[model samples]
Target chain A: MSTPIETDVVIIGAGPVGLFAVFELGLYDLKCHLIDILDRPGGQCAELYPEKPIYDIPAWPEISGQALVDRLMEQIAPFSPEFHFNRMVAGFRKLDNGRFEVETDEGELFHAHAVVIAAGGGSFQPKRPPVPGIDAYEGTSVFYSVRRVEEFRDRDLLIVGGGDSALDWTLNLQPVAKSVTLVHRRPEFRAAPDSVNKMFAMRDEGKVRFEVGQVTGLKGENGQLSAAMVKGPDGEIDIACDRMLPFFGLTMKLGPIADWGLNLHENLVSVDTEKFETSIPGVFAIGDINWYPGKLKLILSGFHEAALMTQAVKRIAHPDQKLVFQYTTSSTSLQKKLGVK
Target chain B: MTKISIVAFDSTRFDVDAENGSTVMENAIRNSVPGIEAECGGACACATCHVYVDDAWSEKVGSPEPMEEDMLDFAFDVRPTSRLSCQIKVRDELDGLVVHVPERQA
Candidate 1:
């Protein structure tokens, strides 16, 4: 029953498209508040391929993923759009007053005249390792991420994966946990060389056990893990542990957006090419999440959708204001919003 | 065009004529081969397009680069011959290559 934050528009994502929407909406004096599942503004650009170069972005022949997101943030700075990081929009419903109410999994609520779903490929969730029957022990005996270090104090911990998340936690929790076993598919690690060397140093002192293998099976009762069956280079061996943490990286899931009762075409929100508005009025979908006849999931396409969506949003937010479109290059009013006039 | 075959987990074979410079992952998607998600669209980012090289074609297909190897850590049930299909280009040497899709993608 908390008070909802009121705004002109509530953007469901903070990626490149969502960031650009702020610029388009800001030109017409529409305020925006964006919510993202990731801790930062950029979605896939920041998470999946930060350093990976993207060749198709207009004007710039070559730009890295993180660099594109950074530029988008800079472009949208004039809008002063509020960002809610590490939050997922769980509940979405139309209010009786014609405004839309967006709720997060964390219970924060927002009321806006319009909603922009710029969610690209949905939210990035931690990938669950393909070990059989791992779901039963998820909350109790298994954890994909560490929220508190003290939770593993004096417990037998089995850490799996060759990535930095696995190595860093193995080193960090070794002293805190009663016993630590680091298991991987290979001896070669994707983690930093310095951490690998320190891990080897720790293994030499008999403080931690590093095994080259994968957890094939789990033995536990009622979500209480007893031991894990490791298929290693030698053979199937049991590693006794009460807790297990497997870091397999992340995957994109459509998440709660599917439950909003919007017209969907193969898991993507069905929208018109005009304003990119969904079946529900005032609720617009753009970027990769939206589906049209000839829609491309490129950043440029999303940018175009944002510009059109903002014009429609402005009419809804300010019903009495006169509608007049002007270019940022020629219009003093638009330039004033950009703070260049 | 180079010939390549993608064997699904159910053993369904999809033989395709792939263009040179295109990736094995693209050919799988173009032919609608099941079990090859290629979620990242051949960026060598996501490991959903993972495939195991047929024993005979393993040596000719070659091993994954360091970047592709790092991405393979995100894949499920990664075997010794496991490779992200996007990393495998359709070169003439790889003609008549065969790769088996795994049970599930990450």
Candidate 2:
């Protein structure tokens, strides 16, 4: 039996891009261990708004970002990359043996031949507006991204944000939710046009109410989001609701990667284009955290980048081995080996 | 539309119509080709849709831009031919192009 131990790579995030890296790494027969700060897969897409539908992705006609994440998680289910979750990566440094010493916020250190920074543009948590009395009710009625929609099936939900996620969820809950009130900082919406249109339609039909203003106060009664005080153009308004969803959109973070000593183009890790090698030698960057003139920041791009970086890794790991996976003899394993098939 | 043919390490080939404005990765996903994932939704965040430009087409495809270079650090099985298909735009000079998709995308 193969000894269950360390790995060739330790991916920092379980986001789509990071999971995609696992796909490429497995093809190379390279052992890897995946880690993330979140308790589950799908990274930001999972944490921010799993229920929000994503239209920009080319393949899926109309699927929620969370759903796409679900598919990706299924794809990676087979390899079973050593998953370590709810632990954030805090630091990393290369060793004399050419492996990486990856450290996490939980005070855990890892040893790996290489490290992939799939941290999904860094750690992200909801940026709650400056509202008083919001801290006291930490575990009660407040929430970030709705992990379970069933809980809100019969409760009044107050969604804040004109962005796509906020608007889309409002429309999604129109039928099942007992009541939904969408509050935005501005009259215009930043979400997709279709979602915005649906929100407007719901408002016109009296199924939902729209408040254009900023949330100034959040008051809770018995540890629940009981009511909200908003400053609208008209004047102060007190709204009653059971819960509030502050989907202010995701703000990309660079995290401890900024201290990695890699060259940067606007704080992103700079790499040697030919080898995908970063300034740190053994360390590499991939996915949206990476940038290019016309970088697509898509999962496909991350996959492609992983392929190239893998080649570079091969050269580094087995420099003397023939560049090709073939050795003139027909072998069943060769087909799976990443050599010319 | 440009016609680009992409071959995978597994010998799967794709000949799809590429829209003029989209990147190669974007085109592959739109064509319903199996190779590229375009996760992060073509934002260059994930390398799920990586591909290799055939030797003849490498120079024409241009070097990895800074952002693309930055993200390559995360991709597995990095190859010299590797280029994030999403970062490559479909243009006239690249009418007949070829890319290689890796076998696995984690």
Candidate 3:
């Protein structure tokens, strides 16, 4: 018999919820293997706008998405798992031995006893539209969102996407970029009113020029996006641009887990309230992969789900040990020992 | 109060009484709907209050502000029906609307 690769769990996606699961898994003294496509945790938060404000997560009241991610990484840093960065999960296959083997886009392989498909939204795919020769500018000029805003402090940017993401980025880079030109497929804007009003204001100010069309083609000459071709209402035209920030929004393709036959709710994975089980046995789902009663789907909500699911996984692994949650009061315990309030 | 049904991924359905004034996110958070966080306190800055406007009721829920849509990019499971729960006000049209939460919030 082959020796089994034993990890208490393998979590996919390093987003806020996935990292929170890693934190929760540590509480149970379980060794886990965490994987993410992005180079770091925080999922879309880090991938998109790190400086953006976030209010819903429990605690901290109000914090930027990046700051929240920092604190979350801090909470999990103490019990860090084996991290696999820049690795995209291709899919998973259940072995005959009741374990799982996961494959990634990098051709790496991992085996774990339990798998928590924490892959959130699956948007890190950076759903840039097909540009004829955009790949030629990979290292030099053509780009997705501005990874480092400082580098493009004064450079001209050609942005795509009429939705909220596009307009918001335009407004954000208004003060930063030398100039901002926005392109949209439809005449209508899909974002909220505040952003629309701001864009209109920017237009009146001549800070931004809105093109009512879509990006048809792009060519990177001299390691830069020198010519941006678009299909606008007026006609097809090429505009001089230094870089292209396509904010068309990432397309999330739910991975192989969909084949697991789990109960679903409106195309979302469904989970039993008590056990957090999928339609099949041995293969369990948690966090965003599976949903249960009163599922809030927030970071705090996922933490609670992970906490309870960890207990369930532990029971499945070790049926004999009675899992009793021990609420901790570090300050209280220290006070009793040192005779201090 | 208009009656609304919010069936979360957990399959635990909530039948809430939405008034004519408060936003959908506020009503859910106030009534303790299992999923939406609505963390920004109704400000469009926080996308935590994300919810999928049921396909059938999409028009009734209207659309979100540009900020809300931008914030949604950070949400876990964003779809065409996605809307910041905070932006969707509970009105007569929103009556009997249903929402689904994403895998996680930002």
lDDT of 1 by residue, B1-106 (tens): 9999999999999999999999999999989999999877777878999999999999998999989988988888788899999999999998899999999988
Ranking by DockQ: 1, 3, 2
Where does candidate 1 stray beyond 4 Å? A1-6, A11-122, A254-341
- Candidate no. 3 TM-score: 0.67
Q: What fraction of the true interface contacts does model 1 reproduce? A: 0.54
CAPRI docking class of candidate 1:
acceptable
Per-residue CA lDDT of candidate 2, range A63-169, in tens?
Answer: 77689888877766555677889888777777787777887777777888788777756776665544566776554677767778887888888887766668777
Candidate that scores best on DockQ = 1
Cand. 3 Cα-lDDT: 0.71
* Candidate 3 lDDT over residue span A200-248, tens digit each: 8899889888886656677666666777888766778987788778765
Off by over 4 Å in 3: A1-4, A89-111, A219-223, A259-267, A291-298, A330-341, B1-106
Question: What lDDT is obtained when candidate 2 is compared to the true structure?
Answer: 0.74
Scanning candidate 2 chain A in windows of ten residues, the lowest lDDT window is A326-335
DockQ of all candidates, in order? 0.27, 0.01, 0.03
- lDDT for A93 in candidate 1 is 88
Error of 3 at A223 (Å): 4.2
Per-candidate TM-score against the hidden true structure? 0.64, 0.69, 0.67
